[model samples]
Target chain A: MAERALEIRSESHTYPIYIAAGLRHQTADILKGLGKSTFSAVLIVTDETVGPLYAEEVAASFADEQPLYICTLAAGEQSKSMETYYELMTFALNCHLDRNSVIVALGGGVVGDAAGFAAATYMRGIDYVQMPTTLLAHDSSVGGKTGINHPLGKNLIGAFHPPAAVIYDTETLYTLPEKEWRSGLAEVIKHGWIQDPELLKVIKDQWLDLSAVPVDVLNDTIRQSIQVKAEIVQLDEREAGIRAFLNFGHTLGHAIEAEAGYGTLTHGEAVAIGMDFAMKLSGKVLGSSLDSEAYNEEMIRLGYDLTIPASCEPETLLAHMKRDKKAAEQKVRFVLLQEAGVPLVRPVEDDTILDLLKEEMTI
Target chain B: MAERALEIRSESHTYPIYIAAGLRHQTADILKGLGKSTFSAVLIVTDETVGPLYAEEVAASFADEQPLYICTLAAGEQSKSMETYYELMTFALNCHLDRNSVIVALGGGVVGDAAGFAAATYMRGIDYVQMPTTLLAHDSSVGGKTGINHPLGKNLIGAFHPPAAVIYDTETLYTLPEKEWRSGLAEVIKHGWIQDPELLKVIKDQWLDLSAVPVDVLNDTIRQSIQVKAEIVQLDEREAGIRAFLNFGHTLGHAIEAEAGYGTLTHGEAVAIGMDFAMKLSGKVLGSSLDSEAYNEEMIRLGYDLTIPASCEPETLLAHMKRDKKAAEQKVRFVLLQEAGVPLVRPVEDDTILDLLKEEMTI
Candidate 1:
């Protein structure tokens, strides 16, 4: 098969999200072309786990003339705190990194969020590259949604700072645990449900997939997923309008994650459960044609642990979701599916939501 | 005399800078019109001294239903620190301020810079009203150049955050110290030097006895000053190209300010001294036709302490100017006048600059 290089172009910026099997080895050549020589130093921001795995290989790629610094944080959702953000910024400042310097974010969503935000605010922003090492990063890394979590809200304190480039090395995915892969797939599934019905069919067909998928097919899927996010973001840079549609399952998912205390549930895992709950509610209340049996079978085949454990009470989850920044005046605003590829948001009443929870509890 | 309002309009935004005797009383009505608010809470951000003096009067004019909260900082350049920024933002977050929240910056340039930057970053930015109480703010407050000082540089970290409304109450200028009045006149002189040769004659004629000028004339002068500034800003939102003309005296002024430590030499005083030096250099090397003696006599008559003291050596000032972000590499760039109203930038050789300084010192 011929190797295909895909390009994602926007009105203000255009860069390629290179997705290939062994792209990590060619990082030096790729980055040298992207204006890295102007900088005197390069700082690598990674997680505790990922730092040991790929930090050495990535560090060696930078030219021997430029000094390098590696900053690593704990590997969890808790790492996206203000304390961590301040520490990372202090690290960069102490290193005497100037405006010409760049930060390399090399981890999952948490690392990307914190590091990207650090880059955004450090010296009023600087160039940073997204070296996404997780499946969820395929969404977070490409969209420039870099921010730290606020006590009042998740991803509340952030700016629309686009990355200089995104290098998605698929080889890194081999080290991800099954739970992490399942988490990443939830977002991929979300992109399909919101914008592309064909994506849903493809995923549904590959529900019980063998590990025999070609690199080109995986690359195409990542590109299409990115296009869905990029097109929405381009229309609404600040999430004032159309971009809010991207919060399909996140309205409930975030509430559950916050209530469960962040690290207790992986983002994708919570999102997977939220998508199921949203789909069920859609079928009962919003007249969605999604078949419950087919949906459950596909989720099971994809290895989602969708059991709503008794510890997370439906009332508590509902309350947290209502307190979501997206909610106005303590009302849960659900971005429901009118059909595959047709997403709409409306205020859902507490009573109906409670009844929906009661109906889903039987599962 | 009819109280004429000085209307200053920029692209995407418009507001009035009312300069008249006893116009502080007119704040309520003007704010209502500019804000389009019949009833909304106003977040008044002022310094420790300014808040006690005018926060009450400003708050009293609003409708009884309109709530007001004061966010106050110390009244100096030191208050523009990151700690004050965090405290002010935390106050707003605790106050339950929303997107509709209006921030009223009710102090001088330092207060405006700090408060305006706080407003710019809070909730990714909120609308602000500039009720400038100092003459220096006539220039800083109008141009939308809101930022705080870093230890390494002045105004290095900031964004182009234009205020929603600017109410320049000239009545407040009456309380300004004579030194401050001289300080602000430096910027007023700068605007004329950059864009209007006729304005220089106006300044040269009546600047010494500005204390006796009628409030209407003062209003007209301010209007002209703001028009020159607004026209320049309208063309260049960010300091990309032509806007650099605004830095005619700023390069030397900032270096002087930094060398003296920010608060010691009030911004205008340093710029006053810097402008005298620049004009002298312009006449020496660039063949400027303006008689250098006339420049010094006008400034002296206006109560300016134009001498660059022996303590702030020309060598130190030159080094600080070289560290300016505007400087490409280590070379010092100056905005010199080819003729009055025709400002142009060129690199001055270090030897010629040293020669000019040595000559000025001997005089």
Candidate 2:
């Protein structure tokens, strides 16, 4: 019951983002506070791995609740597909969930995206809570970019559907492999780099070994990252203007992900490469000292694989980027870094993009 | 183009409602304003009946600007199904429509509901316009209650997605069969009965002989009905409160439609019977002088079969109504009329409903 809750206030709703070590142990008290006097049915959407660990604990929390349906899918980005989305919707309908029913999403980014999209479309939207068990989910669950991937591109069909609440239990991260932890940290690093230079400095100074990082520090970092995302989402719920800034590392990142095929590489790894390219382009265009060669060295030292794979050529990535929904006409837009706390979206010329790719390949 | 334009102003949007004798002549100009310069694809959704006449017209309107994709479904309530919705989504995707792509609903209420729901979900929603060709669409086009039907009930799966604009070309009514005209007028009659007693009197007087009623008067009546619907929808976007008033005849009417099989009888015809039964119950419970007997006589004179079909037994109709989305706690709630101008949702006891049905059958 280590409890210092992070509060999120949106235009339409206000809820707490509870981040604690082993918060799953207090599920009953949290459900009571959320005003579940009589739970008729609950749907738990999870992945192949996390379901075994926490599904029973959550179901036990609501033992008196009749007919709790637990549905699990295969882990990874490939699961975020139209087929899975359709299956989940049919499951919800078969479960006879009224509007009062709550769907709990428990896994990493893929599970959150697929499950949340299901909740958004099933019966024209319903209440959903994010029980994020992976570090990547700490970002995806909070901001509510929920949707499945289209065959043409990653996240081509989706909606901005905020969850009813987010429960990030830090204890679940203890079982995560080192590579998974690194994969998650890229996003945390991006958040810090984009919004808070102070947080970035703190991570740079304190984070050396992934295993030994204090739970409180990790919780604070996740909460701060979520707060930054939540504030941006509140200002623009539907990504009309400033909200597009959240695509800081996503333009080239998505193309790389789509080219490599989903599940070939973790999302954060692709994003790590995209962020490096964007920073290089940002330095070229904006001449920011923040994007200097030292910044690249720092990123490499922080255990980020910042190279675009030889299998996915820069031209292929460019072709995929053109197919993205954000592209206006034939020109693709990238959200590049102006400085540590400032980002800008601009259309880069094809030759310049090619030159950057060529130069970065030698490194 | 015989110009008649009025603006509909709501909190989220302000658009014009246009009515003209031959407004289809202005389709090109109307679409030019609505079509995005970025999207090169246009999807026109129409019914089998209307497709032959107007699909080419709409296609020609957008000929210079974008590629037109015409999709026609069976011209009835049966078209409002998950299969139809999925097909429409696939059509849009296959057409290579991005976010900027536009959908034009070109038939009646069925087309509007089906197309609007497709737009609401396709690519997580896209822009759409309502080019309503029938009088009943005055209600459906303005309210944004777009949905596909579930096996359990009508509008069981839906989203409240407002269209970009509504273009009502009154001249299309010249091609409508007298039966089709009568079918649409049922909704017009319901709108008048729920909110405007004066409009009801005008219809009753002018519509004594359906052949004698001028098209201008009919158009005005439908437009007024649309205003009433739009005003209520503005107050309650979703059917959370005031909007439920619009479902006055829908509960029992839906049951009758479903029981009879969707294509067997027109929507308005089913609603006309529902109205007769509702008015009779209202007179009994609310002590209103509705003249339910006279109402039945007038409907019969107007060539509407106001009596419930013998095959539609009371218990079966009761079962359908109980399964209706509007029903709560296993009670079939009826929106009863205290007077022509006032409607209230009341829970009618099972015995009371059975008595009213028996009495109405005798009458």
Candidate 3:
């Protein structure tokens, strides 16, 4: 029964993360294990892309068990809007889903986020299971953070609502493009940078290859990444203290996403660049002796474009950083890493940040 | 400082409920007491009705302590909507109100609910203070329940987020119409029915008069009502168990509102009628020997119109009841009162409920 799975025991909630191949077909059996949730209905919140591929298979898994509804959203970051969230709620309510209804977030980070947020707020939160189909979701699927993007800021409107369980099927990863896989790998790199050195070795073994990963290797890699995420989350579920370390690269990454415009760079690509800048910043501020060239080389080899577009003004990026959702008191705070597993969230002056941005981002 | 105030010690959170007159002018002083919230920015979310009367006073209370912004939504239930929620998030984000910002929900239940919901989600939940102006807010102000209505359901989307504090200024209630006072009273009676009998006696003394109550009596009554609410909320912050009792009348009341059309009857009046049906059901189902005449007399003398309108179909109301957000497994369960301080939630057979609905609702 213990088929490559680990349980995340957060401060407030404890749930399992199943890392295996073709586990999506076992949705019903897995949910029956949730002692408290006697859900009589299931709403599979999926996107046009993931829905077409796996929604039917997952829905068929619930045959005669209970009523199951599938809601297909437009695929992309745009679907994580209030309009989409409202539509999903209307659709759920229209289908007569009651309190015992469970939402199945079936897709990557975008689908997980939007669907998870819907679950967070629907009837003041209903039980939801994360059926993440991408590697980026390995990061988001563990943490209870769920939300949609506001036009002014991404994730400005959200909640810290955890899923009941995460059922990840590595088989689904086979269909993803190499760039998508590379984009997801950046977060795995982040998990390694923040917590596990063994994960770094795993990535190093693959070198620059993103074409394909053997099933067993992929499952193990996902299990390791989720373990790092689960440990951090268990320590600080609400981002009160150590959880801020999870944002190691997000501070500058979010600003770049804003300055360069979202959809211009995959989230992992920007975060990879952000981690590089944070690394250098750590060396300057915390006096950490780390090999900058090797770190840069590893990211580049992993197919991440760390080049900051010239159009992204240092001042604008700095402004975006200050306005970051994680920035308390409008201070530009970055999660600076001294080394693997040791991180600090501290405010850096605008001049210091601008100096680094100009030096690194302007080619 | 033994003022007329009580603290709510909920399972997840403990916050103060200050019940007094002229507390609006004391916003800055009250907020300084929160230990961990080093908020440098304040967003006072009020409505047109209340903002025009007190926004400037509350904003000035900040007094160079920090930056404060006021966003006034349109006054009414319609304001408790996704559009308004989105607009408020946009406004707050545009003003650069980051994670350290505090939101002041300053108005009646609508304003408190909408503003509190924004606080619950903005930057994935920030600190919020409830400055309830209406008597009805005494019920909503305590329970950490924050939400906006969807097109399909009332409060279809929300969160169980507690406030930093609830500052109830009864001086503001003086401006409220008598109808609003009576409307708020319905919840006071609900609290009394489920928890405290003393609160019921307090209301009995002021029978048939919506005009005015002395400041001392008003303050004490609100304190008692809030005390009952606090105790119940402390037991179950989320409606996992005992918190369901708080929905004694709300189960059918919500359906009546939906079927009879919202805004036709105040929330309190609909609830009062729902309580009557629940009381009668409790007698028949639980064999509780309660005087129906005395209960009916109290509501009538309290100036509540208990008529359930001829247009409401029993089957339609039954359907709505089954679809209630609180309903489990699509079963129409109700918080039926055996007597004061003894409430039991049980699912009534559709025929049983239909018979009662036909007998009582069909005038």
Q: Each model's C-alpha lDDT?
A: 0.75, 0.77, 0.85
Clashing pairs in 3: none
Model 1 Cα lDDT, one tens digit per residue, A1-363: 213355555433666667777676666666666744666678999999999999888888767867789998998878887678767877887777777788889998888888887786666667788888887889998766677766765665555567877888887877877777777778888999889878778777653452334556666677778778878877776676878889888877887777777667778778877888788778767888877677678888877777665567888887777652422556677888888788888778888888877777765
Off by over 4 Å in 2: A1-15, A25-40, A63-67, A325-329, B1-12, B31-41, B151-153, B208-213, B324-329
Q: Is candidate 2 or candidate 3 better by DockQ?
A: 3
Report the C-alpha lDDT of model 1 over B50-133, residue by residue, as the tens digit: 888888888776776666788888888788776676677778776666656778899998889888877766666677888888
Best of the two (1, 2) by TM-score: 2
State the TM-score of candidate 2 restricted to chain B: 0.90
Provide the TM-score for each candidate, comma-separated.
0.88, 0.92, 0.92
Instruction: Pick out the ten consecutive residues of candidate 3 chain B with the lowest summed lDDT.
Output: B322-331
| lDDT top scorer | 3
Output the lDDT of residue B26, model 3: 84
DockQ of candidate 2, scored on C-alphas against the true complex (2 decimals): 0.38
Candidate 2 residues B199-239, lDDT tens each?
Answer: 77777778776644677886777778887787778888756
Window of ten residues with lowest summed lDDT in model 2 chain A: A323-332
Task: Tell me the spans in candidate 3 whose CA falls farther than 4 Å from its real position.
Answer: A2-4, A206-208, A310-332, A349-363, B1-4, B206-208, B307-332, B349-363
User: What would the per-residue lDDT of candidate 3 be over residues A66-166, giving only the tens digit for each residue?
Assistant: 77899999999999998898889988888777767899999999999999998999888888999999888888888888999877656778998888989
The DockQ value obtained for model 3 is 0.72
